[model samples]
Target: MPPTRPSAVPPQGDTGARADAYATAPLLNCLLREVARPVPGAGEPRVYRLPSGERLLRVRGGRRPAAPEVNAGGTWHRVGHAELVKLVAEELQAHTGLSNPELPAEMADSRDAVAALLTARDRTTPPDDPYRRSEQSLLTGHPYHPAPKARGGGPVAAWLPYAPEAYAAFPLVLLGVREDAVAEEGDVSALDAFGTAPPGYQLLPAHPWQLDLVGPSLTDAFADGRLIRLGTTAFDTWPTAAIRTLYAPEHDLFVKFSLDVRITNDVRRLWRHDLLKLRRTNTAVSAAAPSVTPGAWLSDRGYRTADFAFEELAVLVRDGLHTHLAPGTTPLLAAALVESFDDTPLDGLHDPAAWWTAYLRAVVPPTLELFARHGVVIEAHLQNCLIAVDATGTPVQALFRDAEGVKLLPEVSRAAGWERLVYCLVVNHLVEIAEALCERHPDLDPWPAVRTAFERQSLRLDLPEATALLTAPTLPGKTNLLLRWTGADGADARYLPLPNPLRAR
Candidate 1:
């Protein structure tokens, strides 16, 4: 049977073209990286041979590849987002010796989601603060995931108002859980600052979207008075790149909630297991913060939830920028540097090499030293990192966050942990930044500066893994596309070796 197409037709005019472009870049990136072998030739448009079905594919541009075409019947034909999804489905099934009905649908849903976001963005005004704008600028998220923008296949109306890409900000629903039923740990006192609870209750803020999702499950809790609706917060919280996490600028606080939506790979819930381990993880990362120096760690301070609905209604309090950020330095999401935005530091870069070197200095030392000295493996991917730039748009400091994704040493074998670090730091973080910079300044070679940064850190920290990284022929590249297609755990990261740019030519 031919593949099923997405329900929503592509939007009309320039919006349609833009939706296609935004959606196609990441899907093409995944296909090219994981499954397609480069065809030996250089020209205006690059070509690749899909080994699974022996099909030929071509695309123009680098960094964010666009205008995809497939060769069939002795001619190359342009393929839109829907057709691209079909082609990916066919290639994956053939390549993996497996079939997946869900992924194709998700790919379609993701494309449709982009269209919705583009439309919503037209009507909304982006945040005035550059930092907030950077935080919300991930239009094409997770550059290698097939359905990075997929919103659990829900209606646009259901999710659009809360979408960060659409510059969304709204008040969080406040609930009062009976004191006896409240389960919490550490410094969750930050949550109580939102609003007051009645005589026998405690304040618990919940993501309105999450409440909409798990409302049915909490019906009895509400009926029995375990949970009471106390109305929404008076102030608004801007949704961050991580949709489940929101930033309350008024309070200078970040609150993460258990969203039962499948974003990217996992159902993004504050899982019981992760929450149980949250204190231990946060403590360890906090203790390791000194090793990063001027670079800092945004510790997940604590979490709060009702015992009856632990995972469904749980909320985590994270350290906000005001406390951790250096005086006068502006923190920009690291992902935004690669994704690009209005007035992004990279946009007006006068010296690409110097800018990149400063970036490496801010980001690399902290990531490696934590692993080497403190035995902390932070998931220092772009989203989890914030690069604080000075007034002149030069990167001055790096701040890392998300304890839920942090892995400590000894708990994980050194080898396993090192591999994870390399993938997250080098492949996921540095490669994207370098490519984006090089794309902008084609005359500059970003890798040598990267190599120097790594070598200097290896010597400074005496990290053997860092030394080995320089000579290594291949870097571990996460296979996001195949992982999703095979229905693997999102945490169960499988890597394919890509030619290491750090290695001397």
Candidate 2:
């Protein structure tokens, strides 16, 4: 990682067009040029900064268009366009419990329409009846909303991007309350009942972001922890303003916000901290084996940056796809090792050493090249990545989180930031995993796999950039994961020697 800087700066909603009002809108371009300049007819729109540092423009007179009077089951409530956005925000916060609710382009219209649209979005799903019929409002209590499940109940629908369909969010409301309770009583303790805290990992004192999920109970938890030594107002780069909730009923499951310069420097540092925490959590989770599954990602509630509060909602599975490497699980380390040595793994084929080879090949090159590609880059270190596996011994998923690691393509930022991304993602993450894989699978080659991954991902890069990523040929030291340098003639293979077994004894 580049020399760590002590500090830094700042940084949605659904659109109405596609899914309905409650749907996430398209990303609005914040460029000043994109802003509609005031003219004769349209009033000067109100500009507000979102939590992520993006800007929101409200047309001064933009009202939610009036709906035609209908003799329908439910009456259409009249509201303004901006009020619609606010309601959407409130509803999202109410449902998803994320800190900020985004409004994309499609949802940016009048009030009554937005509300009707939001209602329609939820109503589109099939109701949970014996026949599994479709209904507009499946889960009652709050507003008439979509039902995530069909009556017979196969599997819930996949949550959508932008405008969040009420999959997980709506479930929080379903926890403990009656169908009508959500509608009448705003409090949603009905669902919080199901969220059992993992053994020893007591729920950390929640920040405001988690208000919707944990309910008011967090306030009590915080006060108790503070009165004792357990709770702390320590800063995680943000003067303790950013509350990190931990469920260490047994072990530490780190909870922190995504990067937001406006909120505090901690947001930017979250990736690194989380990585460290994941490692720690993994060790703890492993120790408690029979009781707790080795968990990784925890939910991130509310995080406010400059103008808006970004809401994060999700129950993360720790590298669910790549968990074979966990303790007691058998992994084909030999195949992983071979892949790290070269680029021969991504051909839709598998090798015992596929994991190792792929790591060295793909992870390292992109990381090292990031600096030259842009001035300010991102770090794709270990914490941001999630390695997963399927039933059979095979690599299935490699989920990368913490968008903060995505550096500005050098042209956008600077060498300082850009290089951090390269170092963190490629060198730090890929290399370590490659090393671990190599330790397990010695027979497989990592070289070809490394080469193959670079060739695939680097399809858009130039030769030099490509070469920088594939810097294996230039590294020094036999034990060094990246074969940085192989001498003038590129003579012979020089691998790191095995350690003396006697040393352990």
Candidate 3:
């Protein structure tokens, strides 16, 4: 569908009164409805009583509709029919890939309905929507965008060309092919595509199931008693890791290859296994996506052989970078910075939101093209970021790594699993660390500064042209958490300052 102006409430006559009115509105009900909580009928909007005893209006339904439910006041409210239809259609599409039922009777009529909705967008009442942005634009950080075609070339110097000499440092080279290559190979193994190997070349079987989607390739290679493993450690979660490279001089990629997969799948050591596999995937894709650095697998199979253990690989990062900041100074330094300034953590967050900026610069436009105008909630924090600097202690790039650390909007994910994702990505990581910064720098607009930092990261990724996603939700908002946190002095900290206004709504 063509992009409509993002939904927003019109400015009222006075700023303070309007803000106060929104502050007293039934924001929680709005969030619940957005999350697809059932509501009453169409004519009757969901009437919710705010904490301050103010009343607010809520309705659901759009191109996709939410579940219908009865409200506490015994009044009837349903996800507005318009919104309900939209969300339900989206949900249906997610499950069966059919936006509407393939009913013989209404199939033809539904076309008219779709056309009307598309045409009458301006007249439609917008539903409760949260701030969101896309991240596919983030691919530019390290030059992972596919190289432009050579004017006239039989073969050009692409980064990972199929060559034997390039295989010297690492013996076994894992190559993942896009699905088309698999069909080209037919029944033949990935090895057959490149012709017979020179002496010391061995074509290990690519994972059988992956061969159809991601192309097959040589799994391992041995040169002078050294083993190099390649392609990827993960083949299922994503469709990409069809090949991996294991390369190290004088070390067997897997000393006991036969027993390796079995031990790593063991239950108890799962965390270690996840760490190794995640690190390995991060290493390869970082280069593939062209992020912070391109990390490849290396060999270190001797000392540890526990369940979830995978062989090690050397990831190629800039020479002087380390993952963390200077020792001991990290947590305290973060807190001290916030405290010295006398500002709150939220103040340091980005204004137009840095996550959206970098994502637009790095991942979108020419590469992914998934979103037209996106709003990505970056969720950057200590654990999700690497504060890399130069020789003079000047900050360079705030490396945003870890795919699992970011949260996409509910519309993108479809499932309402956002709460957990938000908890882990935003509150758990970025806010937690920013809280320390705020404690030290009380005078700073911590949130906006953080947003500015996100913008800096975006600029590093070459996204200066795109827009950012930093506007807070414009509707009435509130938060009512069920749990509390205890402070260092053992005082109740459960009544935390919640970020989203609609949380209580």
Candidate 4:
């Protein structure tokens, strides 16, 4: 189907096609990553050996992987998204004897959410700005996550307005927190500039989704004048891939709010412990970031919240893209750079080899530098990093964010921190990107550039782990399937070794 223009509605048939494609990608990713082993050599309908001996599974290939089938009775029986979820559930129950009633619904909800997004977007206009387009472009998120697109099982009417994929932009709902109840650290004064607060109150901006979730509980606070409805910011903010985080392009600032929704693995809440350590972690990373490159860390400067309703009303203020962005360059989401975008810098590359090299340079150096020189373990996953491109859309710089995700060295044992860094930086970040480049330009070999990027970096000589990374036979791949099935904390990442393509040929 052709791309739908703004104010145009796609035919019902096209919506279903898009929905299946969007929904199945994550399901296939989960199945292949957790239970299926390759059939060694298979054509078109790629075959895999399921855990239950001799039984085979087949799927159409692509980054997303689609059209799954199980070979039985000398025929391939097709499995739609619902059947796939059941298959996964049955398989997990047999494997672990664990039955999660919640996860299955979430899986179904994720697919339903995609169908709704497809249906809604057909009638709406995609963002015209390149940055906004890239930010709103993720239809299939966290490619390996089982229910990456799930919106906490909320109704389409409740969550669709806030979904980034639907090109959501809205003014932040502002509130006045009584001065005595306001507890903040570092620089949150920037938030106050969004709106005015009366003499004894401070401004607190909230994500509307979060407000919807927690508003009923705040009745007493409102009744007692502890919280006052001060209306919304004058301008609208774009929701980034991190749903709770909003970018106010007009002010060039970002506001991170505590949301109760479970996106991907974790309930998107600003935990009290994380809020307390926010300034320390941000300071450490900010101090380390500058030494690495012109690329920067948007400091999670500070937060504002009521002591009574702390995490519920908490908001973290961070620097915007403009200050950290390289001059004259357009910044794009790093994850979106890998996704299929109409005018992504990765599109129609004249020299993919050079572009991949530049991508490695812009992204890798700063990440490794923070780990080696400063003991800062950046969760330098694709989503956390942004690639800035020049006028012609060649990548020029990399910017990193999210203090909550960073693990400071010595704070976490060196070995433990390095493992997390490897999973996030190489397995989660670089590997997918390499595949994306290969997918875009099939004839091009992306690994040699990857091998060179890590092998020749001077910092690797200082950090012993970097040397091992290039020649290492395997890298740690996060087991998102098993994690969710076993009900583990999202941060408590369990990794299974994956074949390392960065090895010397």
Candidate 5:
């Protein structure tokens, strides 16, 4: 039987409290992981000491920690989102000896964004489709990023309508670029189906929200005959977990646009350098896909944009599920399994161990094999992966997408590539899912199964990294809190050692 649907929406009137709880978890995770030291003890609410300010902090729950309290004169007091932001800012400043005016505001903006999303979700009906629900279910996104949901700190009205968390689906605003001014590579033929351009132009669809942001800069192009506004797409495209990328079910296509907004770490524009390398990176992954069976690579087919507004107006066409997904399966975002939704396959499982085993089987091998054989290190983080399940909710296949995040072996040192893969696959992806599964099934220990998965895959592929992974005492956890505090580039990943769950008995 298919899983029953439960309301994933926040309880009606407690939106503020719910938002605070949802927002606080990730921020706390960042602070705890990057700056604070855990105070060892057996207790209901675990305690931690902020090394910078010598402050005592405690929180209830694991994975998504809540009910945060700070010790003041040997007494505990609750801290709300605002107070928590203040606390984090102070802690980070003292810890790093660097004050960032922007990150703190972003931390607060992220909390406010959650409140706005909750308010929007209350009025909006979630999509009945399980896949759509799973894609939109990331209310507490990037569980370790301080400002995962901050939409460039813009007013809620500007970005909320385009938010995937609110179950938003909107039509793409089509534009016509003068044929002479068009700069494109690979196969972007799917874009032509959206609408027709005049004889001298090519059809280029733009994200409505992006169009609004970049519209002012395109005045000269619009005023001249270089870019003409065509109408909107007849069918609405649903935004995936990656905010700028949208899935068009009707066309069986995924179109990614460049948005000039900071989401999580960086401004999400499709930069010229990345765009220049897209085809090469995508080609390598596509070639490697056949070697890894039961796991598919959703090929980013091509991109289209006006040469005049290359990065700002660029749109990428990606292969859709019709071509890649298995016959009798529905693909759910792997990240969604961590941030659950109504009818999540992980919910009420008869045997969570078996389910988790199958999950590891579907997800791990392809990632490891691709690296060992093809020298392709995909960003196999939860958001970039899709776990397809049968009607019985058994994970049958894994699909991975997003070419922009991929790394080629020789391009980066073998050690660097392997480090990136381990961080993405182990710390970011598997750990989150394992914790979520254990959260649901308290008696189930997920690490042994994880160890077995890696061991089996390592033996099959003769991958030395996988073998070493089984015994590694520490995993490289990305220092997102420190990265932002230091104003490091988003792509410039820095790692701190985290206790390896796989190595634990």
Candidate 6:
């Protein structure tokens, strides 16, 4: 897709008025993916059989499905987010005979959140910096998630100040942890540069919102003089697409903090179990994929936290783009690449096929090779991946991060790991880019090039899943709508079968 105007200035005015359409699309996708059924032999006005006593649901479809209607009495009526939420609640209760008042409220809350973000954006100018703008560009997040924008049903004021989508940036709150209570692992020495801690303590950086979240519980720690405030960083760090992670442009570093809010399916806390396993996962990934020219891994160097408030105040030191990113190349979040931006290098391409070829060449091989050789399963989803483009805006490098999401072999069954790998790489990451390309170049069939990319790599990879991958009719698609509604653990991913594009001729 061509780099369009600022997201706030979409094709339709980005007013509170169009927030319904913007908010409704993702909701509809969630409903369709999780519960809606298609009417057999239905013609023209596309109808999908929805869950509430088998009600007929209709919508205009393309990439952004719109104008949802449900058949009631003799005619069709529009279903806004409120009505949609009610319908979903009713259907869920009827289908499972279990009422979830919370999810319905959350669905409505998500709509309201979108409205607020739109209002905030229209009044505030988006950052001119491409990277910052890209970071803030996710207005309608997770196209298939039910409550993608819901901020734990908390008041907007509680989170709005630090919202990356609102072009917000703030300095991290640094703390001095008592030397006795300081619990750290690996090389977190870079944290020492944020500010000097008193000789009796070590430097610890924390997310301000999280600090505010757990303030009452931490009273004893502060009273005992285990934690001391050391002020903030000189330069403000911009929150990346992952809300917990912040990128400091000056130091060229990323620091991840634990926020207990539930963004999508899971509470965003950096759990102790995951943190305990981080070093081993990170080391495996680094060894699995060495310093390949166009492919790199941004290591999560180490983490620092006080033993007293382990998960709450933890800060992860991540390798910055400076070392991994090719010199003279600008890297943007792959998630933002799919959304509307002021200037996207992908838009500059004269040939979609050639550009697609380069993209596949840069991204596909290393991931396959990693799994085949090292048995490291990378959660290479959009938020965890970045594509760096040369001066021409063509992609030159692929960088991946988030060791917490990576799984090693034998930790999970090989089949289970493969399912995760396919969903993240193919369904979550590649599908979005492919759809954007097809939208811009309607005549171009991007899947054949995708097929070619896999075929070339299959020769190098010894994995048996490769042949089945090219021909499998269905692939695992994470059922976010159901996952959230059922209150499943965020990492406890349950996938539904989706029509596989790779299988399409």
Best by lDDT: 5
- Summing lDDT over every window of 10 consecutive residues in candidate 4, give the lowest-scoring window: 1-10
Each prediction's TM-score against the native? 0.96, 0.30, 0.26, 0.96, 0.97, 0.96
How close to the true structure is residue 390 of candidate 4, measured as C-alpha lDDT? 94
Off by over 4 Å in 3: 1-268, 271-284, 291-381, 400-425, 451-497, 500-505
The C-alpha lDDT values of all candidates are 0.88, 0.29, 0.26, 0.84, 0.89, 0.82
Off by over 4 Å in 6: 1-14, 41-45, 291-293
> Taking the tens digit of each residue's C-alpha lDDT, what string does model 3 give over 377-452?
3323322333322333232234343332223444345222223333433444445344333333445334554455
Instruction: Write the number of the candidate with greater TM-score, choosing between 4 and 5.
Output: 5
- Per-residue lDDT of 1-505 in model 4, one digit per residue for the tens? 2222111112246666666667778777777877778887798778987765546788876666877888756788988778888888877777787889888888988888888987777788888899888888887788889898999887899989988989999999999999999988889889878999999998899888899999999999999999999998899998998988999988899889998988889998999999999989999999888788856788899998999998999999989887788899988898886675668776668998988888888988888888888899988898898889999888889999999999997989998999999898888888888877777678988888877777666555487787888888888888888899899997788888888888877
Candidate 6: give its CA RMSD in angstroms.
2.0
Which predicted model would earn the best TM-score?
5
- The alpha-carbon RMSD values of the candidates against the true structure, listed in the order shown, are 4.4, 25.6, 22.2, 2.9, 2.2, 2.0
Residues 1-505 of candidate 6: C-alpha lDDT, one tens digit per residue: 4534322223666465467767777878777877888787877566887666558888885556777888876589987767878887787777666767778777777788878887787788989888778878887778788788888888889998888888889988888899999888889998888888998999888888899898898899888899988888787988887888999888889999999888877788888998999999999998777834468999998888989888988899999988888889888888887777668765766987888888888788878878888889999888888888888778888998999999889899999999999999999999988887776777988898888788877876766687679999898998887777676777898999999999857
Q: Could you tally the backbone clashes for each prediction?
A: 0, 134, 109, 0, 0, 1
Candidate 1: Cα lDDT at 406 = 89
- Which residue pairs in candidate 1 have backbone atoms (N, alpha carbon, C) closer than 3 angstroms, thus clashing? none
User: What TM-score does model 3 achieve against the real structure?
Assistant: 0.26
Question: Across residues 408-445, which tens digit of lDDT does each residue of candidate 5 receive?
Answer: 98999989999999999999999988877777777999
Please give the ranking of all candidate structures by lDDT, highest first, separated by commas: 5, 1, 4, 6, 2, 3
Minimal lDDT window, size 10, model 3: 130-139
